[model samples]
Target: MIKFAFLIALVAVAVPSPAAAQGASGFSVVNQTGLNMTNLTIRRFGTQGWKALGNAPSPGGRGSVQFSDPDCAFDIQATLEGVGTVVWNGVNLCEVKTVILNRNASGAIWVDYE
Candidate 1:
């Protein structure tokens, strides 16, 4: 019986669990230039307005900005970082800008765009 229990435990440990859903959505921005940016702001869907993510004084700096909701999803309007704001949905909790994720959503989390 003890051996069987041990075997079951081993099997459970070996199996991988499903990925956790985003608790709070956000973006991580890295300054990759020689100039400093001011009044950096980030906004998500269902929010009143843009929330200040962070500010960088110089290039090669990194910052993180979080959304109000863990499950909150948003459409990026006027990103101002890239060429233009692109529509995105189903962002995850605590996810930041540096990491690119698929906006298309399914059940609880956003999946990678195909």
Candidate 2:
């Protein structure tokens, strides 16, 4: 009985806490496009009213921004200055720790996950 109790105690000690068990709840956006990005906003999956990046109207090339997303899932939308917009639907932010916005071979906006 004592051996069993000791084994249970060891197992309990090995268990991870809630905070430690939590996955990635934040993300960073990397602007690889040569032009600035406008109206960069992100919202919880299926939720309304996208939250803007900041006061800036547009972000320049190679610029990056980080934001908190406790829910770990989101829908991102942004526009390229003087160009069309780029939208990422149903993104799992936890699985994608970083998002890189660039241009594809066809000259269209491409979204990459890192």
- lDDT winner among the candidates? 2
**RMSD in Å for all candidates:** 9.5, 4.6
Off by over 4 Å in 1: 1-20, 23-27, 45-48, 64-68, 72-114
Candidate 1 residue lDDT tens string, 1-114: 999999999998888554334445445645443334455554566666765555533455666655455444554322323233333344433444453322222212223321
* lDDT of every model, 2 decimals: 0.46, 0.68
Off by over 4 Å in 2: 1-26, 55-60, 64-66, 95-97, 105-109
Return the TM-score for candidate 1, rounded to 2 decimals.
0.38
TM-scores, one per candidate = 0.38, 0.59
Question: How many steric overlaps are in each model, in order?
Answer: 12, 0
